[model samples]
Target: MVLETSSTAEASIRAPADEAAAERDLARRAQRGDPSAYAQLVRGNQGRILRHLLNLTGSRDEALELSQEVFLKAWEALPSWRPEARFHTWLYRIASNVAYDLLRRRQLVSFEPLPPDHDTPAETDSPEVRLHAKQTIGQLDAALARLPPEQREIVLLREVEGLSYEELAAALAIDEGTVKSRLARGRAALAQIYTRMQT
Candidate 1:
């Protein structure tokens, strides 16, 4: 089921302790085969998961499809759920694996970036300014596409998804040191690419 955008934002603003308690409760219920609890989990996480996948794959359609797969996998794996990791981090790990598998099957290196959605206020900007903004976004997207998949994944997880070092290590199944090293390299590479594009 599609979650409303407003609800997602509301979920994000919730107190962390309260949210974690709720998530743990829901996870417990879901592990016990409660469909409603599973549905709640999906509603809570769908937006961020979709956004993360979109940035990773650079295609809304692919992201949407892969997100469905992610939820399904999560459902199937619920019985094995342990609270050792945060539910969202587990979901991200699933999403990363799903995106990587699809990219491999399709033999795609990267996707061309689409224009930004209508979130930017049209009333505030002149056409020339809007055009420039789009161009810059496009340039950055191309630079992101040029990164190796491992580097790209690290950059997207750290920068776009805002995963912490520990969270990123959990999601990517790497040690924290590896996450730090890859992120540093990824940021350096992205900066170089962006610079070259500007020149």
Candidate 2:
């Protein structure tokens, strides 16, 4: 049993590296104009890209529309894509640009409350506790919508999407120092806004 558990742990740790390698191979094939390979790459990444866009745009309809545009732009640019960057990271760069453009054109930020979480607090939490949790999530979402798009994107990509500093820089076409400073400011602003909302 112990050996089985150890093996499972090791396999879990290796999964991301394995997935990245597979994606790189697919990207190379797509670069050579293989439609099937490109489809597979899109299938593997679309959900995450969609979710990321949804967070950035705060609109489901816009996110769905922008996700298709991101993939289309990726296909057009595939020939120039380098293997050194993770395929997903490159896709996100395209997505980031597309989203930023939309935000700039709209000149407004709006966020609905995040979808209700069905799995949290176990089944035993009191109604009051559950209500409080829901309210807190709503407040956080509102705070995010209030932030400038530039800072909001950094905060979402770092905290919500779990990107490392280097990945954030590559995805946003910014330097690591910029990513760090923006994320710091974004987080501080979010905290202040959330605090104000709670009072």
Q: What is the lDDT for 119 in model 1?
A: 26
Model 1, TM vs. native: 0.86
lDDT of 1 by residue, 1-199 (tens): 2468878777777777587788999999999989999999999999999988887787898999999999999999987778888899999999999998988998987666654771243557998987887777777788988988889888988887788999899999999999999999999999999999888
Worst lDDT run of 10 residues, candidate 2, spans 113-122
Q: How many residue pairs clash (N, CA or C atoms closer than 3 angstroms) in each of the candidate models, in the order given?
A: 0, 0
Clashing pairs in 2: none
TM-score of each: 0.86, 0.87
Best by TM-score: 2
